[model samples]
Target chain A: MTKNILLSAKGLSKSFGGIKAVNNATIELKSGSITGLIGPNGAGKTTLFNLLANFYTPDRGEVIFASKPIHQLPTHKIARQGMVRTFQVARVLSRLSVLENMLLAPQKQTGENIIKVWLDRKTIKKEEKLNREKAMSILESVGLDSKAKDYAGALSGGQRKLLEIARTLMSDPKLILLDEPAAGVNPTLINQICDHIVNWNKAGISFLIIEHNMDVIMSLCDRIWVLAEGSNLADGTPEEIQNNPHVLEAYLGQ
Target chain B: MLNFIINLSNNSGYIVSLTILTSVFAIFALGLNLQWGFSGLINFGHIAFMTIGAYTTVMLSLSGVPLIVAVIIGAGLAALLGFFIGISTLRLREDYLAIVTIGVSELVRLVANNEEWLTRGVQGVRRYQIPFVDWEPGILGKVIAIALLTGIAIFAQWQLLRGIKNQFKEYRSVQNKSYQPTKPIVCIIWGAIATIVILFIYINGIISLYNYHYQAGLMVLALLILALVYSGLEILVRSPWGRVIKAIREDEEIARALGKNVFFYKLQAFMLGGAIAGVAGSFYAWQLNAVYPTSFEPLQTFNAWIIVVVGGAGNNPGTILGAIIFWTYDAVTRFLLPQLGIDNARLSALRIMVIGLILMILVMWRPQGILGKKEELTLGK
Candidate 1:
């Protein structure tokens, strides 16, 4: 069955000081699908993610999101177009409260403007109340509603990852590029994260995840793409990729 | 007691002058707080904004621009410079901003020092007209006016505490459930005590208002400007825009990832801070009745930084307290050193040594500052 592509990257390449971090990497995220990108260490999975999100400009090739070219847009602009990315280390603002971290996700807030922040107090307050409600509800869903007022830095490593995922939901993102959501997380929270991802996918959001936990990638991914040495190796159904000799060799070589 | 009152009143001019100077530095420190305290932008050359503000206001007004218009333009020009500087440097690492700002400040001072055609060079621009010059009330009238203004200020302080208490009512209730009285209760008590002290001073007639009305008027003007700028900043830092800046300060990369225009926000903060410094500069020029390139040394910028650090970075009230503490220490040291028979050069060195000692102690004992919250510091543990 064919699925509509929510995001696609073609011929993306990036280099740092004579080292090709990512070379001619091509991938796509289909709508309402949980796609997995797996690679050995230094296989350029994160570089690909950076290029797709416009965090780094590609030396070659282009990215299209929601049927528009996005290579020229800023990372935030790409995010505003319903594509959001999370860091592997869970980059929550450590000093901000959990709820504030959530509130920071929404785009185009009227209160973000200097003049409107002063003059449109009524509207800004109303919008803030609504955003707070939204953040709280999302936090409740993730079992973090009680810790909403706590500084994000105080959260356990697993909780910080959960908070990052929860924060992305605040933007009402159509596609989420999650970099290692399960890395360093305990087993129980990892299970919880997988369940949340599945539920979110069922509810119509697409995910492009870079993860090393084979169990997570195997169980959650509808399709899996493998990268080796800064280039695409193979992409297929989880079972097909599991049996593919080339994919096996890439892992063995690493 | 009467003799003491009479003696103090005889020196009212000196007291008022000291207060006016403190108020000016307080305004400068407040601007620094907005940038370094809230936004975590390291502006090492903040004095440049003050220099531009002072020079522009004086030059423009001298060339026949209206006083108010000139002041606004001066602030606007400072803000414009800040905007450009932020654009060129905000994207880089934090230390770059510090280096650039310090360099920029030196460059501005040098320009003012050499550009005789513009700034009048070493001689400085003196005898510039201050606002409300035509409305000078006589000595007795000025005294009464200052007393009234002090009363109003105390009342305003009380009201401000009450408003803060109301805003934190929920948190106080939560804290009460945990067996703590509301913190604002202490604040209210302090406000009450302050009001009573002012009343005591008025009833005792300890300080005569005679021959000091002009100074009193300047004091009132300084207070008014402080109230305006402080309130504006208070409102701003509490707004969503303020939150964004705080987030940027915490981590610009995360802020950008969350779709905030980090550059834009940083630039805005830089400019607003510069504009505030510019306002302080105008008041400073009024206090000195002159603008000289030498007056804007890097030491003045360090003084503002010390005020912010000692009062507590990120705490507005702390900034004011820091300014008062700083200027009082300065005045007291100057007076005491002379009385102690310290020669001029030695006296200056001793004064600096005392300030340095105080700063060292403060940094060691209360690095977060006198009023700063632990979590609010950029270097949170």
Candidate 2:
């Protein structure tokens, strides 16, 4: 009873217009675990992420994160409560410098306060330096600190994705719902990103990566769930999921 | 040479007056720069703020409130109006908001003209008090002017020394200029504004020192406005915050996710910009020695919108430059074009028609205006 469930979504159902996008979807993610969700195109994988992230609240179901019901909360509120989500297409604040993009992530930012900035000069500088250092380390870990001053818009697609990860870390997030981290990234960088995720998971950050690449999911996910037509099709280990007849028939279509 | 000296001396008054007056409006333009330029907030009713400032200042002063207090009251009232309008309409789709603001501004003008007891209606408020005329102008006036100038200089220096944001750069309304270019034309505009201020200080010094008469001050005020516009734009463009404003303009949802309270920031921009408009209106009242609702018409707000758009939406310096360019054309056209046998009243209509045509062309040929970044204009994907 005291197993410490990090996230639990039960009987979640949602529809866009008249079409059911997610129905009867249920999942339990344990604290400090790496979970992967995979489904083919139109399998409602991204929509499920959107629902959990509060981009669209489920028409029916309860979502509990860290034991708090988060169904009615806004996406930003969810983010503030140590749960951040990334977009499938990559959402970068394109006009800002890479440093600015990183600086924006840390929740309850101290720099935006007009009074604090004017009154507490020494303290602000110290905190700013520390945050900058953390952001630099994250960027450097992701191989992006060299371009910290560059405009985020000018970066390549893969680099932007990496920057998003670096940005998410600034919040010291408890959970990250990555839509498709390896979607358009190079094969070489794909492994690097996966390795980082595995390492971060080892350090106690939970992640639910929605990946289409079977190999990456097999290598990274502790457990995998497959969805087809807004319904749960299969759930098991990498080897078990690969040979699930229902998953092969409906999702993989193999 | 004697005639030349006399002409220069006499003409200096009008030139200084115009420059200073222009600067005042430039300040107003900077306010608009903050709202529309920085945050992509379209405040089509900007002139209403000016009207509120002018009327409030004049009415309060005429009612026996201290001059400085009245000025503060006037600006405060204008800012209040801005806050209300921003709160109500900022949530609407931008195009709808533009239409609503234009209508609200018109309503304000109509109410001002009709409020006979309070505003004097068509008669307008007159014989208002002028601020800072404690002595006769000429040689002695220079000392007073110099003293005030030194005080301001010392204050600015002290504040900067203490590391407080000098001139409230953070509070100043910004315009979007991200990725367009590093050099904000506002710097040049400020230089132009400064050159005018120096000219006024020079002439107002020997010609009429310590005077600080309303009109002379008004003239200098305009140049001051111009300088504020110039510097405000430059400082905003170069700042990290200015980049954030442009990001909102480019993509609101993105800014929102990045921990920017997009709605609140936009609201702040609107109120600040509106307050600046109030300052412009106050100066206008000072220049004419009067205030009324008719002076702050919807057309005036529309004209500013045109100025911003024609000059360039994301360019604050462009707005100042556009205001001058447009006003000069109006002055010249109203004066010179009529000599070619065109009716004077029709010239006003003609000017508006030309503005409409220019906006059309700009939207068609280059929707981003003369100096705007295309990305800034794109809104979002």
Candidate 3:
């Protein structure tokens, strides 16, 4: 059986000033698959994610998600279509409660409409209760339920990463693009995060992760794409990427 | 009790007008709080909305539109102005919005100054009708007013009770964390004292209804509107719609990633804030019985800013407290400075310097303002 493509970007290129930050990069994420993007610094891995999410309009390319062209859509509209991205640094709303950070994830909330907040009180209340419960359960799954009332800023670095991933769960996302999930995390927490990602993938959510940890990338990813100096260098399985001389030369500098 | 109220009200004109002015500015600052405080939109041209509101209402009333309808239309015009400005500038960086707003405010004031036919130029617009000017309420109307006042009093008491209960819950949560017992105890005492003061005011307001004067009636209406706007904002800031704007405030990118329409939410907040400021302008015109170009100066926008900052930007009740404190300072100094033998010109200048000093001290000592939470401070972000 052939798997369907969930997200596909074709010949995406972005230039800033005189530099080509992301030069003709293309990647495809199959439905319910875990894919890894690895690149040396300044390789434009994050910029490619921005292009895929439409946070930056690529100078030239088309992105199709869930069989619909999304390169022209606004970032929020693209997110609303069941695809969301996390930052290289966890960008949580520090002023709001952890629960509020989670509650903000679910798309199309009735209470989000100002008029309905007053006029549709019954429905809003019900929706809020349901969303709260869902948020709590997701938090509990990640062992963050106790901190629900605490400010998101109060969470530790690893916990904030966890919170960011858990927040995406509330949005019912079909595909999640994590910029870096284990950058500042400890070794133990990194393993835990990888376990959570595997569990979530098994639960039918697709992931496109940008990680530098070879262990994380090799163990969690079904396939890998490598970039160097803002261009795609190689694409292969974990063993193939490990053996690729071009990728080795790019990282090791001859 | 009636004799006491009569005596108090015999000399109440100054106090009544002062209270009305405070209420009007409180409403104005509340609008700014929703924009800058909660939504993090720096609306440096807030007074522009008030000017539009005042002028539109007065002009329409002069042309025979009903007073209430005129007020609504004025607010709508302010919101429309906000929409036009927002569409043009909200997509830019935050500082750009600030610059554009200040420029637009100046533009608005200049137009009011230049349009001789529409606004009578520097002569200003006057002779518009004030609401309840002929409120010689019959026995039935008087009774209804008393009942309404009593109902609001009861509602206020209930809110106070709820506040105490919430305080209790907070105390419980912090019980094991080396909490200071005196803090909540002092708060409870203050709440009790305030409840008593409100009861006294309710009775005084009822007695004054029997002696019905237009200025007093205006005071009552102004306070009523302020209360309604206050509670409405309280509800809004706690809603999910408010949550999205707040999220936008913290990081629009994060809100956008979470599927919130960041620009739309910003525009909504800006327009709604302008509408509220417009309502405040209508009240201001009614309070003064006239509208003048000088009254809508850029200084008024800064006055609202001071109120929001001193009261705690994100806190609604704090904004009202800031307005009351501000006006009290102004009123007290107006009388006190003359006794110190200062002439009028220097006295006015000295008054501003003192306010500046107080603000500087307050910000240095308690950067979050009186009611603002330390954790919620968005400054320096």
Best by DockQ: 3
Arranged by TM-score with the best first, the candidates are 3, 1, 2
User: What are the per-residue Cα lDDT tens digits for candidate 3 across A74-111?
Assistant: 88999899999999998898888889999999999998
When 1 and 3 are scored with DockQ, the better candidate is: 3
Off by over 4 Å in 3: A1-3, B1-7, B174-182, B189-193, B196-201, B378-381
For every candidate, the chain B TM-score is: 0.87, 0.77, 0.92
The per-residue C-alpha lDDT of model 1 at residue A220 equals 98
Listed in order, each prediction's TM-score against the native is 0.92, 0.83, 0.96
| Model 3 lDDT, residue A199, Cα | 95
The native-contact fraction of candidate 2 is 0.16
lDDT (Cα) of model 2: 0.72
DockQ scores of all models, one per candidate: 0.46, 0.33, 0.60
Which tens-of-lDDT digit does each residue in B1-381 have in candidate 2?
Answer: 677547756665665566555556667777787788778787788888888888888888888998678877777888898788878877777887788778878888888888788788988888887664453566665565655544433433342233223213422422232343423344345445645534444544334334345455555445545555455555544443454566677666666555566666677667767877887777778776776566776667767777777668767756766776666666666668777787768877887787678778889997876656555445333
Model 1, residue B358: C-alpha shift (Å)? 1.1
Candidate closest to the true structure, highest TM-score = 3
Number of the candidate with higher DockQ, 1 or 2: 1
> What lDDT would candidate 1 get against the real structure?
0.85
Q: What is the DockQ of candidate 2?
A: 0.33
Provide C-alpha RMSD values for all models, in order. Answer: 3.4, 5.6, 2.2
Candidate 1 lDDT over residue span B272-368, tens digit each: 9999999899889988877789899999999999999998888787798798789878878877789998799998998898889999998888788
What's model 1's TM-score? 0.92
lDDT of 3: 0.88
